[model samples]
Target: MQNKSIGLFLVILILLSACVPTKNIEELAVVTARGVDITEDNQVETMLNIIRFDPEADSLFTSNTGIGNTIKGAREEAADRTSYNLVEGQINLELYGKEAAEQGIFRFINGLIHDSQVSDTMKLAVSNVSAKEIFNIENPNMPAVGEHLDRLIEIEVKNNSFPPATIQDFTRVKTTIGEDPLLPLIGLVDEKPTIIGMAVFQDDRYVVDISLDEGFLMNLFLNKVENKSVEMTLPLQPFEKYKINTIGIESKSLEGEEFHINFLTTHGKSNTKVESLEQLKFKTDTYIEINLTEMSHPISIKHEKAANLLEKEIEKKLKKQYEELFKKVQEANADVFGFGKLYRSKTKDGKITEEEWREKLPYITVDFNVDVKLMHTGTIQ
Candidate 1:
């Protein structure tokens, strides 16, 4: 009799478990992406990109705009327009308009970071235009804008096309010296979100735009690249280019005074491509040297010799451009290159804050010792 009773109970429990509650995923307002922009009236405008589901047709996305004095207020307004409560759990990406970010992202990013429901790793970007404008973009090659963006970031980081900048990285760059925060600078191209550069920040304010090539170089400075394809124009051959596909940065070390730097890329590739590889090696070395020496810079580069600092006019014009570039960023007081952090490490005091570092930044001089080596020109396989 007891066995019969237990069996009956077990059957009832199984039946109850089998019956799923009415949970309509389609009715839930899922926020896939968010855009923050500033209106002409100087009010904060929050835009939510929600995926609307349909039972009879393909689910489509829609946008809702809310204007208010604060991000929360604006978001609440947007939520009221929909029957379902807006959820942040599905937000894959968050974008701030150029003007909004320039005003300072600290205000907007703070609340989002504190929300437990929000993914701390969601991809963030600075849009070239108003963040809301990006919603009109669509690319069938990558269906679902939010998922496509998430994939773009995942693939690029995997392929080493750009540095890995997540919530952790973004916050770290903001607080840490010898570093500045950067976000992917994205704009739509033919209805697709395209990465044009890396958005540079000094503290929390948007400072400048680092182009794709410059972004790669900055990643190299940050030692972020691994197994990246390197394509260089053969100098002597002209127009002909060679590729070091699957190149990896073994290690990068920055050492020296605040005024000078010793940037090195070590543990280079170690295989060979052809017989009698000396010529190839020499050519590779020369190419790397010329590339570094001819870098188009913003600031000037000069080494002190015999107690005197002198500029050589005969230096490659391209190298001069790099000097100008560095100088511009330096003068702007944005430590995007992490020189301030390097200075702190090499100091005797053992402590220097970002504020103090910035105060002393304008007076500091800087030079580069950029080097690239070919450990082996060929693959083992």
Candidate 2:
């Protein structure tokens, strides 16, 4: 009776297992990154980085390309060239070519939004040249190109060096009434993928590219700045008046030498105000506390006003930079700063369309008030 009972249990277990379906790992091609581009023939080109399950492969992943009418169609063509089933559930990054971005990215992004398998946290970037060129790069140090780029952007965003541009973030900005979208721009520097700048977009169309310095300033406006470092080069002529003469001191001359300072572990906050709704004017007050980590030349700390003067110089330089960056955005007619949100709130109906806001953007005036404080001058006596 005991043997019969055990035999019946085994039969039920086998029946339950047979009801489920499974595929061998070798039969799956797991995609970690995808690149989309438009060919000269106007066909959609798709590049995929797939993880290899075979132990005999030289690299952990391989890249392949396919051209078709649409992103889905292109990938289907790529699948026909491989025996393994192409799976996109693990995709960590998606890149768009310059031409695709210029033509507009909403159509491509719409497909991603509807895909149930794609993760909301997947990162998106724009390639300065072509996605195909980026995928073709072979770096000995980076065996897995997709994984390397994924980790690179993650670390840079965490360090506050680059803007956060995940799919979720992009969707939020795109759907928001008063804001525009920005993406990280990737380029090939010495055959290695590098974060060159931020790609500014006006209503899904690529407008302009801003340098990383300008991107950092944008980060200051959008989010709190903490644990960030900034390097500045100042005119050394002003520091000549503050120089001290020590009997045994031997220092370089201030003539034709630029003052370089590195601010480390900075913390800052920014507050925006609608100065005049009718006049289209706004004001932003920014406060920052910096730790002076390194300096090209030393100033006499015996004077009580030395630190104050240094702080003032930094404030002046930063304020100018902010103004210049704002002017660039205005010229491009892209309101990446979200100033329109303030204007919209003050409207009588609290309604402002993107087209109306863009028309008002060029004439909008902003006053940037920057205050810099030197909290610690590391060992620079």
Candidate 3:
């Protein structure tokens, strides 16, 4: 009886194995990155960076192109070009072209949201040029364009230079009332991919483009930054008395009429509050501990009075930058800072509409209080 039962079990195991579909690694085309662009004729064009498994291939990755009226259709068209099964489960990055971003990104992003194979943590970015052009870029230094771009944005976000922008992050902000989404803006500089700044979205449309400096400030308001850098050019006339005089030594000074100081923030935080809803007044308190990394002219940081002067100048400069950046954001009516969310939270119903916030954003005022602490002089007095 035991021998008959063993034979039956073996037969069942063999039948189950034969019923399952088998996939070979060498026959699978793994897509690492996807780029979406709208053609001049208003058709969807999808470019995929597919990993090549053949050991004899010239490169580890290959580009596959397809065009259709929809993303899924384009992708299916792409699959026909390759003998291997096209897979998107490994996609680490998604990029939308300038045209697509301007038209609206939610539609392209919506496809990803419904697909269970794609990870929510994958990074998303907007390109100033066509997404196809970005994929075609050839940089010997960047053998894998998709992975390189992913790492580039990852490093910048870790340094607090760029804000976190994943598919999940974007969708969350889009669904939330009184808040908007922002993504890293990438462009080719000298024929090489580089981070231009950030794309500010009003709802799902690309409404405004902000500079890298402005993006850093947005990160300060939205995130806790461990390291941030700011460069300031001050009038040399104010520090003329602090210049060192070497006796009997003739030298040409490198400091021009303008004195430049570079500060590296060791820690940074910004807190915002609704001072008055009726008056449309808000207050933001920003505190930063910075280290002096570079100084064109020597001003003794050891001296209390001189250090305080430098701190005050840094505070004033940062405040001015924040105010100017906020003004631009307000003009575009893109609430990337989530100020409207704060307003909603303070309301009786804790609810606000996009149109309502847009109408009030232009009129709302924010008082900025910047406090700069000189932490270290970086081996310089």
Residue 238, candidate 3: how far off, in angstroms?
Answer: 2.7
Q: What is the lDDT of candidate 1?
A: 0.63
1-381 in candidate 3: lDDT tens per residue? 999999999999999998889878888889999899999999999999889797778887888899998888999999998888998888989999999999999998898889998899999999999998898998787766778789899999988996798899999998788889999999999998888999999899898899988898898888888877777887676666667757787744546787899989899999999999998899999999999999877665677787888888778888999899889889998888898999999999887788888899999999999998998888768
Ranking by lDDT: 3, 2, 1
Cα lDDT computed for each candidate against the true fold: 0.63, 0.86, 0.88
Please give, for residues 1-381, the per-residue lDDT of candidate 2 as tens digits.
999999999999999997788867877889899999998998999999999687777767788889998888899999999878998888999999999998888888888889998888999999899888888888777766667778888988999986699998987887787788889999998889888999998878888999988888888888898999999988777778787666787855665668888897579889999999989999999999998888777566446588888888889999999999988888999889889988998889988898888888999999999988888877765
Clashing pairs in 3: none
| Preferred candidate (lDDT higher): 1 or 2 | 2
Find the candidate with the highest lDDT and give its number.
3
CA-only RMSD, every prediction = 13.2, 2.9, 2.3
Misplaced by over 4 Å in model 3 are: 1-20, 250-255
| lDDT for position 325 in model 2 | 90
Output the worst ten-in-a-row residue range by lDDT, candidate 2. Answer: 295-304
Per-residue lDDT of model 1, residues 1-381, tens digit only: 999999999999999986876547877778887788999888889777787675654657667878887888898888888787677788888888999988888888788787888888888888888887775565555545556667777777666556776777788788887568778888888777878788888888888887776665556555445555533222222111211223485432222211211222232221112212122110111112211222211122222231011112212322444456567777778877666665666567758887887887676554443334323312221
lDDT, candidate 3, at 45: 97
Badly placed stretches (over 4 Å) of model 2 are: 1-21, 249-253
Best by TM-score: 3
